[model samples]
Target: MSKSGNPTLIIASFFSIYVIWGSTYLLNKIAVTELPPFMLASIRFTTAGVLIFILAKFLGINLAISRKQFLNTVIAGFLFLTFGNGVVVWALRYVDSGFAALEISAQPLIVLLLMRILQGKKIKLMSMIGVILGIIGVYLLVSQKAIINQENSIAGMIMIFMCMLSWAYGSLFVSKADLPSNYFVNTGYQMVTGGILLLLTSFIFGETWTSPMVWSTPVQYTMILLIVFGSIVAFTSFNYLLKVVSPEKVATSTYVNPIIALTLGWYFLNENITVQSMIAAVVLLTGVYFINTKKKLLIFSRFSGRLSKKLK
Candidate 1:
């Protein structure tokens, strides 16, 4: 970690991700209390995107993108933000934020599966075990809670599951696609594209910004927090980490964020946490750890070789 970058900056960036990104879930719940999910998210992302773009321009960053590149950014944005983020916010209406975060924490497992299916990569034995454990963890997490907030927890889990899939594909696509060199600028374009898509989607769903006049003080603050800390600060930190540290190290945030979100939900919203939920969190995060770690122990390498020989 020390060799990766300035040790202080790395610690600060990790802290930003661990706490700020984690808190976004709770903030989303607060915002959705009064604002419709699509409209709220559109506002959040658009404002942040525009601001970031302007800042990038002021910093003399190249903002030029070709038509094809722009379209890729748009498609990636729809996958990453419109579908990925919008659904999570919408599901918050039906689900506890903690549960939703846990579902998202299983994304590494989903990404591994997608890599195998879409790209023909072989799934290693340890990674296969990680995927199975992730599935079981999610099953245990959602089994006990059938309904929440008068909506189906099963449906919420399904939506969040889709969110993970969208993010997984979006990330994979972005990695292969032609994107801007500057991470901040690329992210800004994606955000703006997603915000526009969400705005159109809001109209399609007949979602009106009818509650602006009646929006609570807390809701307003929640929106500000999301735009400032959640979108700007935390996202910048994440991008910074990607540039300076190994992605595997940064991936640990998936596990930490859920723990922080669960604690906050229980502390602030008085959300009930069962023994099963705790155990499931442990299982899910452990699965994520396995998927993220690139190092192979001798046992797994030998076992994989033996299995391949037998199969051949």
Candidate 2:
């Protein structure tokens, strides 16, 4: 890879988002088995946040910022990490990581619609079709009856949808916000603020949190892995990506993650992927693909309104 403009870094960043973040879903699923959802996230963010800040200062990355920027970054963190990621942790108690992955894959579709609403971007007709298909897929996936889920699945589905929604909104808002010129320094503040909020929420909710030493060995390892790889490494890569690449390009990771999660969940966690889930995954992912790509793509999307009209 040419080092011109650090293309390698970009590719590596994308890979990190795809593989590392993808795996985090399963990692989180495992961690929450013994750890409370809020606290699990608190630990990951707080540790990662502090480390990022220290590294930034050590590297001579300036941390100075206006009050407005600080508030915006932290608020974005609260929305994305706290409400978005935090809720997914809670939902895992009822939902399988694979199922949650499928739901989270809808992030691109949600972001597309949010951009149309928030930024006045004109969405193509085929993109609308894509969005509609994604909705149907998610509905089918969630509505299909499963013995393991019982009734909590309904609440689980709702919470995961909220996670997607919160994450989508955060992405949109963060793009528009002015933060530190250095992405690492800016992200550090967000993580710290978000982690603090999560800790406070854990306290308020009385989550029956346990000390890490008391947790099982597996949980301990998972927590450690999340802090190091998932939060610090993947998040730094993601922040770098946001600064360099088109948001649409970065969003492609959403498509990849669910597949990784589904495969890992089946292989390691033995989570069931029903016929409905498989079909849902295909439909949902295909729709998301269309939403991200231009008018020229696999069959159906190739004839998106503009192209069809041009042909006619």
Best of the candidates, TM-score: 2
lDDT of each: 0.82, 0.84
Give stretches of model 1 more than 4 Å off: 1-15, 146-150, 210-214, 237-251, 295-312
Residues 1-312, candidate 2, lDDT per residue (tens digit)? 111237898888889999999999899999888788999999889888999889988999888899999989888889878888888999998888988888888888888888888889999867887899999887888777673347587888888888888877877676667777677887788889989999998998898877778989988889888988898888878767766765666778988899999999999999988988899988998888778776445565555666889989
TM-score of candidate 2 versus the correct structure, residues matched by position: 0.91
lDDT of 1 by residue, 188-245 (tens): 8888999999999888898978655678888878888999889877876765675566
TM-score for each of the candidates: 0.87, 0.91
**Model 1's lDDT to the true fold?**
0.82
Candidate 1, clashing residue pairs? Answer: none
Q: What range of 10 consecutive residues in model 2 has the weakest lDDT sum?
A: 1-10
